[model samples]
Every structure is written in C-alpha cells, then in structure tokens.
Target: MAPPAGYVNVRRDVTDQFYRYRMPILLTKIEGKGNGIKTVIPNMADVSRALNRPSSYPTKFFGCELGAQATFNDDTERYIVNGAHEANRLRDLLDSFIDKFVLCASCKNPETELIITKDEFIIRDCKACGQRSNVDMRHKLTTFIVKNPPKSKKAGKGRKAVAGADSIAGQPGGGKVEGEDDESDDELTKKIEAGAAQVMSEEQAQALIAQREKEDDWSIDTSKEAVAARVQSLDSKLQNSLVLEDDDEEGGGPYETFGEWVKEQREGEGVTDADIYKKAEEMGIAKKHKSLVVLVQAIFTEKIVEEIAGHVPLFGKMTTSEKHQKSLLGGIERFVGEIHPDLIPSIPKILMAFYQADILEEEVLTQWGTHVSKKYVAKDVSKKVRKASEPFIKWLAEADSDEESDDE
Candidate 1:
C-alpha cells in the first residue's frame, strides 16, 4: 500500500526498547490428575525462566536479556515433557509465562496460543496445517531478538573463532588447508578436494548475494512491493472527483424538462465515462466487458454515483494477478463504505477486506455518515443532515419548487 504523505517509512524500527505487553491467559495444569493450584502471583510465577530459553534452535539456555530480544516468539512447545530432570522446571516456567499471553488453549491439541501485544511483536497467523487452535501462538505480538546474542553457560574459556567452536560448519572437525603443493598423491587429493569445495561455492555465493540485494531493494520501498493496494489508489483518486449536480433527473410534472437540464448539469460538471476510463486505462483496470462507471454506480444511489465516479479511478482492464482483483474489490468497498453500510456486501463478489475489519458495525456506519455528510449534501456537524437535507440541499429543493410554481 502507498505510504501516507510525510513519513519516513522503514521496514521495521529497532531503535527503541522492545515492549512485551503482557495479557491475561488461561492454562490447564496437568500437575498430577487430582491436584490443581491457581494463584495469580505477583501474577506469573516464573517468566524469567521462559525468558531464558533461546527462542531458536539446538535449544541453548541463556540469560533472560538475550532470549527476550526476539521480534516474535514462536512458543510452539506448550509442554515438552520429556520426563528428563530439567523438563518439569521448564514446563512450570512456560506454563506461568504463557498464562500472561494466552489467546486460547486446547485440551485435545494441548497447544496454548498466546497473543503478545507490543510494537515489537508483529502478529502472524498459525501455519501448523490444522485449523486455528484454541491457543493462537501464531498471532502473538512479541518482541523478537534484537542486537543480543544468546550467552551459553556451557561456553569454554577463550573465544578464539575456531578454538571456541565445537563444530566448524557442523562437521565435527575444523577444515584443513592441506598441502601447498601437489607432489604426493595424498597431498594432491586433499588439495583437489579443498579447491573443488571453494570453486563450487564461489559462483553460488555471488548468485545468492545478488538475489538478496534485489529483495532488499524491494524491502526498502514497500510501496513498490504493494501488489494489489497500489492498483486501487488510481480508482480511489477518480472516485473522489465525481459529484452529483442534480438528483431530480427523473423530472417533475411537465412544467419544464428537467431531464435536459440534468444532462446539461452533468456535462457542465464534466462527469463522463471517457474521463474516468482514461484514468482507468492508466490504472490497468480492463473495462472492455462493461463501463466501469456503471458498475460503481449500480451499488450506490445515482446522486452518490455521479459524485464519486468523477474522482475515483475505475477498475481498469483485466490482469493476470488475483491481487489486482482484490485491490479493485477493496477500493470499491471503501467507496461503498462512504455512501452507506448496506452497500458494502454488494461491493465484493468473492471476498471483502472491509468486512475483515467490521465495516458494518453500527458505530462505524454512523461515524461514516457523520464524516462524509459534510462533504456531500451538507456540512451539518450536528448530524441533522442524516434525515433532513442540508441548508444548500433544502435551497435546491425550494428552488425546484419555485420554478414549478412559477410555470403553473
């Protein structure tokens, strides 16, 4: 999506201390079948213990400072009860900490999902290949590992690069440079092997670096990476310029032909499909099958249709990506949101992002009417314009009445 004006957007920010706002969660204690104790400690009994496990792999234990630095904690193992001596302490600590982040818990699956809410905690969904469980460990807002590295209590004394390493590149032994010259068969074979490994990796490393740079370029300006939402911006702009000059186009009793006058009013307002289509073409919304304006107009009243059409860009011609379709639907639903709540469901044929955020909530609909009523029919801060016309609208009605009276 396009970044709003006046902000230096970054992929993420880590300049500030990561916050892990705690939430209330429910936990089922499996401490023998008969005994269960529930006490809110000073709340959680041992968050520090949960904070000690390195949030990543071959499972190293560290100081809480290092473990708490992750942008997100997968917290996948709700209970790793291996029956080892260390299992119960970790189990207890995890149970206590998870109670603070509990989204939900499932007895059948034994998964406790927690929702961690903090700027540091970016939300993610469950990808466990089953239905979303009672414990939504996925969407928790969590502070992931930042600048800190996990400190091992098991570390040996000197921190020499190879001397300190237990496994160099995961093979038990460190690699040998081997013989410098190729006079002996054994020396030649070792030299050949080392050379082959280096030669094989050289071109591959270069290719991987080039690929990563391209990805980084896209990350720097995420707007360029906005697959569907960017396409909708053009439609949103066009929808803004359109306005209704006359709502009484069906005409009054034969006093004067308001239909002809209405046509002149629309022309004067410069509301043409061609003008909309020009922007639509640029937006890449394929409109060959139907006039874009007609599709937008069908969802709202004619008065709203004319006004919104001039500004909002039409969904251009057809394209290959499904994201474009999603963008078109999302943009249209946003416009429908402005006109009325009842029209939102009609905007999207397949799926509506507006629905994802509760667009039809009565409070949202009321707020929307209050927000846009000022722009269209009237600027009534009191919201009397929801039913009664604005002063300008009332004057237009009165003017139409006076013209009829004079003709009679």
Candidate 2:
C-alpha cells in the first residue's frame, strides 16, 4: 500500500534502504489481524523524499517505533509464541513500528530512540548522525499513527503468479489453475474449481468439461434430497440393531441427524445440509476425517463444523467405533444445543480432545487403526504424507469428495 498523498513522507535514502534489515522488530513475533510485518522498505529515492519532506511530517523522536536499522542480511523473524507466552513487549503509551521504519515525525530522526512524555512525543534525539535537535512538541502524531494508511492499502506486496488454471491471464476457460497439479488436468480439477476463465478453444473446453463431468466424485450424480435420504437411510440401518444407553449423560431425547440439526441451526435461513458438508470438506474438516465421513457427518452440522474443527484432534482421537462415537457426540449436542449456532465455529482444538477422550473408547481407535481402516487405501492424504496411514486416511477422503461439485 502507498502512503496517502496528504501524509508526510519523512524517509531516508531509498536506495540505501533497499538493503534488507536484520533487526528484530517489536511485535513482529505476534500474528493477529495483520501478518507479523511492519513498515514498507523504501528504495533510496523514496528515503530521500522522506528526509526532504518535513512540513507535513514531524521532526521529533517519539520512542514509539522499535529499533529498525538497515542490516546487511535479509532474514524473516521466526519465533512462534502462543497463549500467555505471547506478551505485549512494548509500553502501550506510545505507538511502535518495524523494519523500513519512517523517521519520527516529532524528531525527524531516522533511528529508533524516542522518549515518551505526557501523552505525546516531547523531544527529539537522533541515533545515527547523533543529534538531540529539539524545538517544539505541542501537536504531533507519531509514525505509528499512519498504520493501514489509506494510500498503503494498495501498495503492499505484489501477488505471486498462480497456476494457469487459477490465473486469469492464461487459461482458455476461466475454470482452474493450470499446470501445477500432479494429477492429469482432468483429475486435478476434480477437487476445487476456478471461476469461468479458461482460455482454451471452445472445442478444448467442451472436451475438458466433458472429461470432468465423467468423474464420479465431481459429477452431480445425486440430488440434494437424494443424498440426504441416502445418508438418513444409512444412519437408520447402521443403528438398527445398535443398543442405546438407557440414560443420556445430559439426558435428552433422540439425537438428530446432521441434516435436521443444520436446518434447526438458523431457523428458516435455508442453510442446505449439502452446502454445510461441502464447505466443511473444502475447508478440510472432511479431509481430516477421511474414511470417517459418515461418522464425522453425524457429528458436524454445517452451523458448527468450524467449532468441530477446533475439537478435531480430540474427535479424531476419540472416534473409532459407532457406539462410542455417538456417545461423544451426545456430549457435544448437550453443550452446543444451548449455545448460539454461530459460535459453533469457534470451539478450540483442545476442547475437542477434552470432550472426546473423556467418554471415548480406546479399543475402537485401536481397532480402526489396526482393523477397519486396513481394508481401504486412502487416496488423498497420500500427497501430504506417507502412504502408511492410507486406511485411516480414506475416511477423510469421503468427506473430500462431497466438496468437488463446483468449478472451484
């Protein structure tokens, strides 16, 4: 993003600024709404422009920015912190900035050494060409105030090129990112689709489309109602001879299928169960479960799949048998039933483990890992991991299949 036109550009030489800075920046370790990066490194020319412009910019050091000196090496910060370990390092009294920092508006100095006073920068002190050039400090805003500057929005990082299928420039049909896939063009596209932007001849597009339509996974072989009824029928049949625990832990009536649960989620809002399942699969809830699609689907309603994702590790650990799975799900139904549907997306992974291991059976997991999953090979997860977990991996593949209908 560019700095807004009206804003002052108190910078140093842009050419010298081109050298990558190695100094660890304040708050750079933290990842929040913004990526852990601050300040646009300017070329020497821009730095010169910043140094020359002082009217709109301040000339005092406001000790708010982190020390960002031009370093000889280019390195990205790599410290990872979570929970309480990630603390606010700098004083909140003043604003702070990182690499390629703009000179302090109050001090007009380029290096980091600003002292805070009252509610604003009171004096100026230069660190490089060391100079304590202080004059007035009544009304001035620090460089930190310029964050997310209006002009900077469009001036940030340029985009990396996407595949021909995903990129707009090269494909015949605007349907997929091109060439980077491992599978044949037909097979790779079966997963997600690009919007209509293919550049191929009409003959080629028709050919590709026709080829894609033949894939069982991507084809709209079943209607929404058809799929739901199929799942419902399967559920009833699967549990037909299964015995129910006489008393529910939280004592409730019969549990609803994911379909009914989703409909009740937004009360008449029309959140199709298919859409819920599709989105969950695309976002990878399904991929994470693989062969356990039916089991996972039983637990995740579209409204709360995100929440389920947080608990995924736990769910993954707990679920191995049909009976134990339902018991754990009963717990979720108990807890989530009283909460807002929207919050279903926010459940943490830790909770998943907590709830799941509590009432889950260890043997079911052992059996699935050593038995049930052994029957089939996982077709997807193989790409990211070794083939050893193939069987356990296939369960998530079933979920993966539901998300492939669209061109995305």
TM-score of each: 0.19, 0.20
| Model 2 lDDT tens row, 295-343 | 3334444455334434333343334346545344333322232222333
Q: Candidate 1 — which residues are off by over 4 angstroms?
A: 1-215, 219-361, 369-408
Worst 10 residues of 1 by lDDT: 158-167
lDDT of each: 0.27, 0.30
Tens digits of per-residue lDDT for model 1 on 228-302? 343343344333423222453522211111112223324455333333333334433343222222244333343
- Clashes found in each candidate (C-alpha, N, C closer than 3 A): 33, 56
Q: Candidate 2, 2: how far from true, in Å?
A: 26
* Candidate 2 residue 201 C-alpha distance from true site, Å: 23
